[model samples]
Target: MENLPKKVRSKKLNTRVDLTAMVSVSFLLIIFFMVVGELSKPKIMDLSLPHNDDGRISCGPMREGENRSITVILDKNNRLIYYMGLLDSPIIAPKEIQYGKEGIRKELLSRKQNILGYSSRNLKPENIIVIIKPSKKSNFKNLVDILDEMAIAKIETYAIVPEFTPEEYKLLALK
Candidate 1:
């Protein structure tokens, strides 16, 4: 009595890894870096400071011919020492100009057409007033190229007075 034959067992298979295409490729690389970080931003330039009620920091009294008022200064190498009114008495004598587009954009478009032709013969409406004076051997791209020539000479009255008096530092130390 000898009859032994019964043996058959083979089954082992378990391998599952399907993270939905790697979680949709990491959420599409975090929405493509948040839309390229908001389209690479950077473009600013809008300064407007000057408000002292009782501090007494006035920039007044310089009116006359065409209600005169210029005074540009920005000296040192790229020199552009303009003049017309007030710097403690400067009704024209600082002239030195130089810096692009036919130098200071043709002297700020001929002083904004001579202060808009003397404010249109006194009816007034274009009181051109620009006093930038950036000394300390001027730099910072000559105060951003004179504030981009006061916005390409459309100047709606300007004033960035950062101190320079002492007769404009002895007229920029006699140039």
Candidate 2:
């Protein structure tokens, strides 16, 4: 067989992608989401906490250490009554003559601690969310006060809403 001289490869076809348009589109999407996310508030609705294996009331997110949703019920005595689940026992109750803030702070801290477990690590209180549920007759001022206290504790994701059944509720109920 006769050997022919090797020829250099021809110019590549369709090998280059013009990223400029794609980059522009990405930037537009980022800008759009930023505008919308900033304008809207995180949906804060009341939810039943759920139960643990021991039949104890579980509040917040079931995963532990992660942000937990909650229900804040205001009883007739102008007292703060909290139940962990749709049917769980009250995990927090306000002390007479004492503000409800203490109870809330304690509960938040406790849940935070419980979630940390034996990992020998913990997250800041800011990452944990407190879903505040005020009764229909609850004073708006009281709700504000509770929110204020939560803020003081560095809880930034606190939500204020009426009752709601989040997907997590059913997931937790089965547990």
Candidate 3:
């Protein structure tokens, strides 16, 4: 055995792995995905539905429009018909108003001003009440647009009335 060349022994390699870089890389990947997920999340609006925990609705008694209420009817073909107060007696007759600054926005602003002046003059505790009624032909976008208008108008009291009365059906039929 001594005559034979001494077998060269291979250097023992370290068995321990430096997990710091690997752990750091894994944490970076996790944080990157989390940030991307949050950024890609879809934005949405909140809708209020009238109902109770027991599955019973409590919308309260309907008010016979006292000229302080406005009913906005959303129909197909992007048609918006609005009137102040009940159909039987309206402060402002139902008319087709546009969407932008020259349309619904103008109407809402003017009407709000009128209501404020009238209430102040009469010394009545009243504010503009908006009732949104979306017909069957109307789309979700129409409802959303109206809701956005309501917000832009800074309307404090508004309700989405899903049900349409007989008079409303007739009015829509005429559209």
Candidate 4:
């Protein structure tokens, strides 16, 4: 028995895991996450701010016809009140319009066409200016809707005026 050669055996490994599949799966998961992150971006609106002191001054007092201005007032309960020209003596009476495609959008399109027609006939074309006023009772959604309408109507000039005059309050109260 001592003369017999001793047999040597190889030790077996406890774990035999193939890391190739796991590495490929991890790479695929990373790629999927990266692609999803790039595809889910928020849409943002571009806004322009007014200059502090632009050295540009009016040559003369604004002509009554040249001032194609409209004021849009957003009140509570989804009510919209708009008037043409100055609030002191609006060319058109304070009219009430609802919020949506059929209401405010239609009104804006009609007004824009009217202004465009007048502008084309005049020697100098004047783009319409819209003044947006949101009351305390109005919510953020209303403000956002008005801004979206401005964009949809292709309105280039607009301003947000926070103050509401006594007359405007009375007008809103009437509705």
Candidate 5:
């Protein structure tokens, strides 16, 4: 019996795990997510801003003539105040208006038509320039809405001015 090989007993362990399929699935999921993340980037609209670091552009000198500029002041609670020409001598006085097809949009269309008609008579070939002044109380959405309105109106020249004039502040405060 001593010459015969002895039968040894060993503990049975449940460590036989096949991880090849799991590893392959995890890699596939990771690659899929990576590709999806790369493809799902947000589309950004192009905004034309002044090159000045202070975010304010120099007005220089105000020309004395029939003004073809519109100043739209954005305030809190979606309040919009608009004035044509200079604040001192406005072609159209500052008035509060809405944003939709009936409010500022209508005003913009009428003003554009009137200006174009008058300019055509004078043979000056002038176009309206829009100056958008967003106040501290205004939000980003308001700015974007105004920009969309500009695009819908087909405005070619517009400027975003974050700095509010004292008169503009008073105008916003009054309402």
Candidate 6:
């Protein structure tokens, strides 16, 4: 018998995979994480706070007709501890520290009002200087909170003791 023409044998099988659903799920997960991520916090350290051009150790002398400055300190626990250099005693303690924006705002407002009443002085809150002293162990979140409070209080100049890098120290030493 004559050999019939042999048909070509097909040995390879083709498989297709659709990645559209996977890509959509990945996109959704990325969006979810982005929205849920923690907010950035400010940096806090124990370095000596900055001084004014004058040789004053702390807040400078208030300008004429100016209200006293508000000096707040943050302890290791990130609490709102404070000492008003002008006041005879401490106004706020570590335990009094609260995390809410409104809470801080209220504290600042009350302090401003109280200061105005003292010494028969009619001082505007804007004239007060808010000094922030955040400890090294304190979290950056706490620093940011205090800064926000100061801004809300409408204080123009604020002071922070920034930790100097090695290079900065060298430069300062030279000068």
Q: Write the per-residue lDDT of candidate 1 for residues 1-175, one digit (tens) a residue.
A: 2677666676777778879999999999999999888787776898633334566544654244425578788877778888876655665566787877898778777766766554423423346778887887778898998888788777877888988767878888887
Q: Which stretches of candidate 1 lie over 4 Å from their true place?
A: 1-8, 33-71, 74-175
Compared with the true structure, what per-residue lDDT tens digits does model 5 show for residues 137-172? Answer: 889998999899888888787899888778877777
Per-residue lDDT for 40-132 in model 2, tens only?
Answer: 968789875556667788674545422244455543345665444333333332222224555666765666555434222254434555667
lDDT of each: 0.73, 0.56, 0.79, 0.80, 0.80, 0.60
Clashing pairs in model 2, backbone N/Cα/C closer than 3 A: 60-68, 60-69, 61-68
Span of ten consecutive residues with least summed lDDT in model 2: 89-98
Segments of candidate 6 deviating more than 4 angstroms = 1-67, 86-95, 119-121, 162-175
| Of candidates 6 and 1, the better by TM-score | 6
In candidate 3, which residue pairs get closer than 3 Å at backbone N, Cα or C atoms, i.e. clash?
Answer: none
Candidate 4: give the clashing pairs.
none
Error of 5 at 29 (Å): 50
Off by over 4 Å in 2: 1-67, 85-102, 118-125, 164-175
After aligning candidate 2 to the native by TM-score, how far in Å is the CA of 73 from where it should be?
Answer: 1.9
Candidate 4 RMSD to the real structure: 8.8
lDDT of 6 by residue, 136-174 (tens): 657888888878777777667678865533542332334
Off by more than 4 A, model 4: 1-61, 116-126
**Per-prediction tally of clashes:** 0, 3, 0, 0, 0, 1
Model 3's lDDT to the true fold? 0.79
lDDT tens per residue, model 3, 1-175: 6699888999999899889999999999999999999999999998744455577755765343355788899899999999987688776777887777788878888887777554422323236788999988899998998888888888878899989989888888886
Model 4: per-residue Cα lDDT over 40-148, one tens digit each: 9877998633222454544544454434778999998888999887677666777888888998888877787777554423422236788999999999999999999
Provide the TM-score for each candidate, comma-separated: 0.30, 0.43, 0.58, 0.59, 0.59, 0.45
